[model samples]
Structure formats: structure tokens, C-alpha cells
Target: MNETIGNIKSRRSIRAFKQEQIKDEELQLILEAGLYAPSAHNQQSWHFTVIQNKEILDDLNESSKEAGKIFNDKYIQQLSNNEKFHTFYHAPTAVIISGKKDSLMPFADCAAATQNMLVAAQSIGIGSCWIGLVSLVFNGEKAKKYQDKLGIPEGYQPYHAVALGYKKVKSTKAFARKENTVNYIR
Candidate 1:
């Protein structure tokens, strides 16, 4: 396989991370990679909140748990068993992806940016995973308060979040892709 293809194939959802913090310069590059992702009409409405403070992380995780209980009882039950699930495998840092709520493609634009960050992190030997559960937090009062604490302005909404740090393990196996999911017109 070609180098780019190989890199894409190797990227995996890294759930476990080392306790060490990522360097600022490397994190900046990862964010820059996300900023370069394509947007609808070139609006670039996405906003990224890079969080590293332990106290704030814990608070967000707790608030998320409370919100999950209100929105998804099943998820709350699962989290009851694994507390770390509250913050995406306890990764040291998280990038909360938010976008203008009025935008027609807010989620899509934020998702593309998040994917770019994930691939860039992988290329640089940093582990990253898309944390959809965090996005669910936007539906409740407590979560809304947390969002405000994160400085996600009144007109913007959280769509996705990604956990980033160094990986605890590596895997070579590829996930089986679903067949017949795509069609090409030529």
C-alpha cells in the first residue's frame, strides 16, 4: 500500500493512554491539522476547545455523567460499571468540537475537522479517539452549564469531541469494512 493509505489504515481508536501530557508544540500541530479540514461554503464555523486541566476535566466528566443519566439510561448504566467511560478512557486531554448552531452543516464540518485531527495525531505517534458521548452532553442543563464554562458562545453548539494522548497499546489488525456500502458512478 502507498504511504498515505498505509497511514489511514493504521489509525485506530486508542482507548488507553499514558499518564504523560502531550507537548504543546505537538498539540498545536494537531490543532492546526484540524483547522485545515474542509468546511461547507468555506464557512469554517467550527471551534475547538483544547482542555488539559485535570480539575476541569474531572468536572466535565462528572457533568457528562449526570447529563447521560438524563438522556440515556443505558449509557448511564454502562458508565456505572466503568467510571473511566465518563471521560473517554481517561485520556489526559480532550478537544471539544463545537460549531455555530445556525449553520446548516455544523456537525459535518466539525466531524471532518475532528477526523483530520485524529489522522494527524496518529501520524505523529499520538493516540486519539472520537468521543461521541461528549456530544450527547449538549442536551441537558448541566451540560449546557459545562458548555458555557468551556466558553462555547451562546450561538454555538457542541457536536463532537476527541480524546488525545499517547497510546498504551498498539494493534495491527484491521477492522472489517462493511461490504456494498458505497457506489461509484463513472
Candidate 2:
């Protein structure tokens, strides 16, 4: 397989991460890969808020869980109620990806960037998890509070987050993929 395809196939959502922080150079490369992702009309509407502070990560985790408690999904509520569930899985670094509210296809653009970051991190021997639960913190009355704290721009809405750190246990295998999910034209 091609190197890029191999990297993509090897990427996994790692939850258990070591306490040691990833190097600044590695982080920069990951962020740059995100920046290089294709965007709709080249709008490049995504904004990244990198948070390395343990206190803030913990606060975001708790706040998101608090918001999830009242969510309509039972699974989310259960996760919220679980005392041991950390939104970011206690990763040493978290990057909040936000998109301009009025941009065309901001969500898609941000998602592409997020996927790019994840693949880049995996290629560099780092662990990464794409976190959607953290977006709950921006859905409640405390939205403005966190927006200010996270320094998200005035016109942007946070879409998701990526948790980054070294893996506590290396994952060596990919789970079996479902069959017949693809279609082809004759």
C-alpha cells in the first residue's frame, strides 16, 4: 500500500494517553496538516484553539458532562452520569476546532481539518482522539463564558475538538470493517 494509504489505515482513535506532553514540533506539524486540508471555496473558515492547561481541560470535561446530563440521548446522559468519564480522555493537549458562523460549509471544512490532524498525529507516532462531546460545553447558558475563555472568535461556533498525547498502549490492529458499504458505477 502507498504510504499515505498505510497511514490512513493505521490511524485509530486512541483513548488511553500518557501524561507526558507531545513535542511542540509535532503539535505544530499536526496543526499545519489541519490548515492544509481542503476547504470549500478555499474559505479556510476553521479556527483552532490549542489548550495545554490541565485545569482548563478538566473544566471543559466537567462542564461538557454537566451539559450532557440533560441531553436527549440516553447514551450521552449515561456518559455524563458516569463519574469516571473524561470528555477528552485526559489527553495532555486539546485543540478546539471552531468555524465561522456565516461561512459556507464550515462544518465540512472543520471536519476535514480535524481528520487531517488525526491522521497527521498518528503518522508521527502520537495518539489522537476526535472529541465531539466537548462541543456540549458551548450549547448551554455558559456558552459565552467558555467562548471567552477558549478565545474563540466572535463570529465562530465551536464544532468539535481533538485530544492529543502519547499513547499509553500502542494499538497494533484495526477492527474488522463492515462489508458492502461502498458502491460503484459501471
Candidate 3:
């Protein structure tokens, strides 16, 4: 298989990460890949907020878990109650992906960008995890405060996040695929 295909097949969600920060240049390459992701109507309405500060990450984690405590989903509530669970898995760097509120297909656009970043990180031997749980905090009572503090555009809504750092343990094997999930029209 080609390198791209190999990378795609091998990429896994890394839950454990080293405390060391990834190089700024590597982070840039990952973000650049996100910037290159396709968007609907060429509307690249995504914004990335990179946070390396431990204090902020801790605060966000705590807030997200607190918000998750009352979530309608039982799984989320359980995660919230589990003191061992961290939304970002304690990665040294966390990026919040936001989308413009008025843009068409903002969620999809941001999602594409997020995937691009993930693939790019994998290709470059970096560890990454897509962090959807962080949204609980952004959607909660302190949303406005975080939006302002994170410098998210006034008209944008935070959608997803990715936690990035050096890997504590590298993952080379892909999980087994579910059979018959794809169909070809041809």
C-alpha cells in the first residue's frame, strides 16, 4: 500500500501521551494540514485554539466533567463521575476547533479539518486524540466566558478538539474492522 493509505490504516486514537510538548514546527504542520482540508462551498470556517498551559487545560477538563455530570447520556454522566477520566487524557497540548456560527455545514467543515489534523499528526509520528468531550464545557453555563477567554471569534461556535503530544506508547496496529460496512455503487 501507498504511504498515505498505510498511514490511514495504521492511525489510532492515542489515549496516553507524554508530558513533553510537541515541537512548534510539528504542530504547525499538523495545523497546516487542517487548513488544507476540503470545505463546503470553499467556506473554511474553522478556528483552532491551541492551549499548552496546564492550568487552562486542567480548568477546561474540570469544567467539562462538571458539565457532563448532568448530561442526558448515562455514559457521559459516568465519565463525569469517574475522577480518573480526563477529557483530554492529560496531553500536553490541546486544540479547540471552532466553526463560524453562520457558515453552512460548519460542523462538517470542522470535522474535516479535525480529521486532516489527525492524519497529519499520525504521519509525522505524533500522538493525537480527537476530543469531543470538551464540548460539554463549551456548551455549558460557562460557554461565553471560555469563548471570550480563548479568543474564539464572536460569531463562531466551538465544535471539537484534539489533544496532542509525544506518545507514551506508540501504536502500530490498527483495530480490527467491522465487516461489510461499505458498499460500492459501481
- Top model number, lDDT: 2
Reference-based lDDT, each prediction: 0.84, 0.94, 0.93
TM-score of each: 0.91, 0.97, 0.96
TM-score winner between 1 and 2, please give it: 2
> What tens-digit string does per-residue lDDT give for candidate 2 at 1-186?
888898899999999999999999999999999999999999999999999999999999999999999988999999999999999999999999999989999999999999999999989999999999888878789999999988999999999899999999787699999999999999
Q: Candidate 3 has which clashing residue pairs, if any?
A: none
Report the CA-based lDDT of candidate 3 relative to the real structure: 0.93
Q: Between which residue pairs do clashes occur in model 2? A: none
Query: What's model 3's TM-score?
Result: 0.96
lDDT of 3 by residue, 38-63 (tens): 99999999999999999999999999
Ranking by TM-score: 2, 3, 1
Candidate 3 stretches greater than 4 Å from native: none
